[model samples]
Target: MPNSLNPLLQTHFDTALEHPNGIKKLRELILTLAMQGKLVSQDPNDQLASELLKEIQVEKARLLAEGKIKKSEALPAVKEEEKPFVIPKGWEWVRLGEVGEMQTGTTPETKDQSNYGKFIPFIGPGDIKNYKIEYNENGLSEKGLEKARLIKANSIMIVCIGGSIGKVALNDRDVSCNQQINTVTPYNSIFYHYIFYSVDSPYFQKTILQNAGGSATPIINKLKLSKIPIPLPPPAEQKRIVEKIDELMALCDELERLKKSKETKRKDLHQSIITQMLEADSQESFQKYFQFLTTHFHELYSVKENVKELRKAILQLAVMGKLVEQDPSDQPASELLKEIQAEKARLVEEGKVKKSEALQPIKEEEKPFVIPKGWEWVRLGEVLQKFGAGSTPLGGKSVYTTDGIMFLRSQNVWNDGLYLDDVARISKSIHEKMKGTKVIGNDILLNITGASIGRSTIFPLNFEEANVSQHVAILRTFTPSIVTYLHKLIISDFFQNLVFKEQVGVSREGLSMTKLSKFPLPLPPLAEQKRIVEKVDEFLALCDELEERIGKAEEKRGEILKGMVNDTYSRNCI
Candidate 1:
């Protein structure tokens, strides 16, 4: 390898350690440099590639006379414009067919039982992975070999059809493959792996794909494949290039393995601490675990999966009344429930909202977990003034307008907030027709059906007027302050698990509002609910910030790897 690249290769880990796909890209860079004759220095004493070409031609002529391969039409001479870059003094640019005997494979008929299994390896595009051939158990019988093209050992195989067009591998065993693959057995046996690495280089892979035709499925026929340009170096330099590629690739593999190991260790550490924090019986133990995480969080939460776990832990603690301390001066949740019920009754009596049917009492066994002293268990429906789902307008999608009242669907509702970028709209007249489902400010919109069943968001307190589809429910509370806490509860894992159990989707049915009305809720004191929401908002914001910073850090790391690639291209190759 070039002496100058040694230092750059040494720093590969430092540049790529933080990048998710850094090592994989580094492997590609190594091969690209090798293809451009920048990987290893040239030796004047070695035989010229011009001499090697003459020897290859003589071997092809002898093989043609032996009838081992069919004679193909002469490929056009390489144009000076075809070479991507200038090569070293001992190197030459040649068409790939000039280096060896090339042939496209064919598959035997599957309907013929006589062509069943035997010892001839039946290779296909699926058998090649990561530049190596992984042998399959299925083999073709001797009769099958007669009907298919036979490739000898030490051949370079490449997929020339479909999405796998550029995939290449080296096979060390005699094989018969399907029509999707093409094989090249080099004239000189020493160039077997050298040829394999050459086809895998970025230059050749790009050429293969660009030449592929067919609008429906990409395909490069044997004639097109044979005409692809490739650089040929002296035999001695070829050996050196192959060795350098192997060494660098092994280093990349080690870096990837180390990164995965570090991430796995970090995942286990963060998951273990989160488990402890959630299961802590007393506040003191919980604080101890939380404190450890607070101090060592940077180390444990570097991976995004750990950040996800932290978010979940925050929601669980908030609902269980352990996120913030309660105050003695505040009204307990049971009294709060009574006041909410009185307000609900007043609304029903005034004919503002339909009188809700009596909900079944919460069973002791139905309670998922225990709450703090000031908290009370009640049905989710008990505190709401409006507890009904919306309905679609007269004409479903045909009545949509470019500008009118916002028509919300389940897709518009998300845990973060409503998304109106592609929201459907209806005329003002149609809005009046669907006034029964009219949406107002301070109302919580819940997705009662479809894939986003458990997601919800509170409408802006003072925003544009809108209407909702049948999939969304209006969950307006007697008190505005409780809506935020209720949103947190709906998104939590505890509530999500129970919500999924109520799905009736095989019949195109939604989760029944009756079942939702009976769903139990863990209600904390009014004062504590506010504090929990604040704390959760604070922590979740930190998570969002951390996630953003991680994404930016990864982007910077990617740029570092990209810098290496651009540098090699500019400095090493013309």
Candidate 2:
């Protein structure tokens, strides 16, 4: 290894591994640099690669004379454009065929009983993992070996076909393998690791991809594999490069192990802290836990998963009436319910809306949790003027238009807010046809079906008019202020758990409007509802900021790793 390059390689290897994928990319960078001859310095005293090439040719000629291996057709000379990079002084470029003998394997007939049981190791792509040849789960008999190619130990094995393409491994034992693999036996012993590293390099893999041809499945045949060019260092330098790669790779493995260990520790600490907070018995203990959380928030919520947990906890606290203090001066929720009942009755009496069917009373056992003094439980149907699912347009996607009334699908509804970018639109005539499902402002939209069940948002005032599909329900309340509170309830884990229970045994069928109407809601006083919404909004906004920061930090790490790899490649190889 070059003395000047030593510190550079160490610096890259020692860089903090904030992301697992980043460390993987760094490993590739190390292999790439090694293959390009930029990983180690050249020594004038070492034998030139031109001399090494001559030795390889002599070995191949001698092997051919001995009739040990079949002579293949001469490969075309390497074109200038085919060379991915220039080598250091004394290094040379050579086709892989000149320094290796290629052999492809085949699978024995499985139906033949005589070939079933054997002691011979029969390797396949699946048996090769982490660049090591593990013991084959299936072995071939002597008769099976006759039907397959037997590759000797120390040979380089590469997957030439199928989804496992470009995976290379070095065998520690003589093995017979199936036809998907191509073994490259180096002409000289010195070229084994060098060839292995070359085939594993990103440059060589790109070449394989460019040459792979087939309509159904891309593949590289032995002939095409033989012609792939490789940058050759002197035999001594090859040894040095392989040794350096081994050292750096070992370092990378250690780094990855350490990262996983650290993450496990952080996750344990994070879970313990959250458990203490959620399981706190009284207001005093809860406040103490909250104080600890605020002081050590960054340590606990540095990861996206931890931040997501924080969001869920906030919502849980909000719905349980534990988020804000209840004021004695505020009106109780039972009184608020009476007023809503009166308004509902007045509308029914005036013939403005039909009287809703009486729902079964909430059983004491059905109540999921206890509520504060000012809160009361009520059915979802009791407080609404409008409640039901929408209808899909007659033509589905065919009837969608670029401009018209907004058509809200389940995808458009999110926990945070409605996403209108991918929301469809229908012609004005179609919107008129679907007048019953038309949504005006201040309406709460809930996804009542499929994967997004329970996700909801309040239809914005900016959206003058819109329609919903059958999967979403348009909910209008007696008061606009309560819609925000209801939206929060629908998104909270408390409601989601109950919603999931309602959907059980009804797989393709969605949540029934009847069942949704019967959903018991823990209603807080009108004044406290506003406070809960405000506090939830405040904490959720913080979670949003934390999530965004985590995302940016991860992205920044990726960019820095990419820049380091690209900058190194350009400075040394370009």
Candidate 3:
């Protein structure tokens, strides 16, 4: 066996606390050690599994005579080549069928859902969770029970078919399962929990799955299952291994809880720091908090989630007019709004765009943040020439072609920009008929439905002519300077939260065109808007750098842990 202070194992144990893939890596190491016969030492005094097999054979004959179970054909002895690993002196590798009988439960052909009673809880694959059998109110009728096989308490159930193939559970209470499950009734007095843990091992799962049939839902027939090889340890050793595993697993659980607590504390601390910065009474207070954050940047901004939170905080600060000092010389947003109105009126008179309905004035309750001097809160509809969703071509396949007109879907619009690679193409004839829905360069695209409700992207100059899907809404800004600022506002956490709150639906919440037009926007002065966009972009780039570094560090840590586990197993086996 490996030494207690083996550097490799020590490294695995030490670093596993922080590695993201540590649990999976630890499980793999345990299986590797088990397969190498290094998990528990062999006891020479214990009876050999070969001798136990003889006793089982005699017991099987007795059961056959009593008509307790059906007799089956004798299985061939395990060949030397069939042995995958070396076993301890007293332990042996034997067919699973030698120690237990494997049988499948029945699925009723006809059953009324209304007839299901409370007492007889009918179990299905869904009833099994985390290696324990749970019962539901559904029950098998008398006729159904006749077809179904009754499984005794303590019997192990294995999901032999469907999506959950290889999942094993133990029935603490007598239960009946559907056709998809196989039940194993152990003849020996070995703890059923030990057997359950053994078969649930990743090694056993992989081996059993290899022989499973079917193209879609793989299944293990009774014949194939009975022939599966199982490693038998001394009954005392089985108990000891289970106890050791329990102790180690408790340690892992504690580590996980500690990690979660640490993350929660970090998130709380980040929010606290941001709150102090945002709520600073004066420039002096802001500088103090900012300096503290910058000094302990590595400690405060280690997690990717924290970096994303930081980006959102930056946007909140920018729109609230806290990012940069407000200049008294700059033009006020009220004057800028008048210019946008004049521009829209000119477009309407020129027959370039249709006039939108008047929106309600921003209410006192609707103001999310205090605006700086020269800034004004206004509806998004007041600043845009047109805000509406696109329409789909009704001709279906006839109107769609491999290469014709580019159709922009909701997915094409990302937070950063538009993605054009997978954009669908529509026929030129169809594009001509839908001329009003055409998207131009610098036009902002926003998702108005589903999970990506508030995502916005600017149309690139390269794709000047593109038709958007119904899910995407086009916003033609009346002023060029405000487009980037508006995009950033929509992408901000405060506005996104508002979108989610106002969204209407049971299954899929969505923002309608009517809602989009009326959504409140914090309008900064035209020059200030430009400055805010520039500063947000610069900070976002830094967030990206931090995220990339954290990801690489996590990956390196995982690799080190995996290497340690492998080295530990190798030394232990040798």
User: Per model, how many backbone clashes are there?
Assistant: 0, 0, 0
For candidate 2, the lDDT comes to 0.84
Candidate 3 lDDT over residue span 99-161, tens digit each: 776788876665454434453556888888976676776776665666667787788888888
Provide the TM-score for each candidate, comma-separated: 0.91, 0.87, 0.89
In TM-score terms, candidate 3 sits at 0.89
lDDT of 2 at 107: 87
Backbone clashes in candidate 2 total: 0
Winning model by lDDT: 1
User: Clashes in model 2: which pairs?
Assistant: none
Q: How far is candidate 1 from the true structure (C-alpha RMSD, Å)?
A: 2.8
Off by over 4 Å in 1: 1-5, 107-121, 133-144, 214-217, 505-509
Ranking by TM-score: 1, 3, 2
Residue 247, candidate 3: how far off, in angstroms?
A: 2.1
Off by over 4 Å in 3: 1-9, 109-121, 137-146, 275-296, 348-351, 354-358, 504-510, 558-574
> What C-alpha lDDT do the candidate models reach, one value each?
0.85, 0.84, 0.77
Q: Give the TM-score of candidate 1.
A: 0.91
For model 1, residues 1-574, the per-residue Cα lDDT tens digits are 2345656655765666677877776876888788778788889999999999999889889989999767878988899777777788989888988888898899889999678587688988988898888887787888988898889999889899888888998787888888999989898898877888889887788889889999999999988998998889999999999998888887677877888899988888888888888888999998999999999989987767888888988998899877887788888998888888888888879998888678888899999778888789999888787778999876679999999999999999999999988999999998998877888888988888877888889899788989999999998898787888998988888788878888677643677887888889999988889899999999999999999988888888888888776677566444
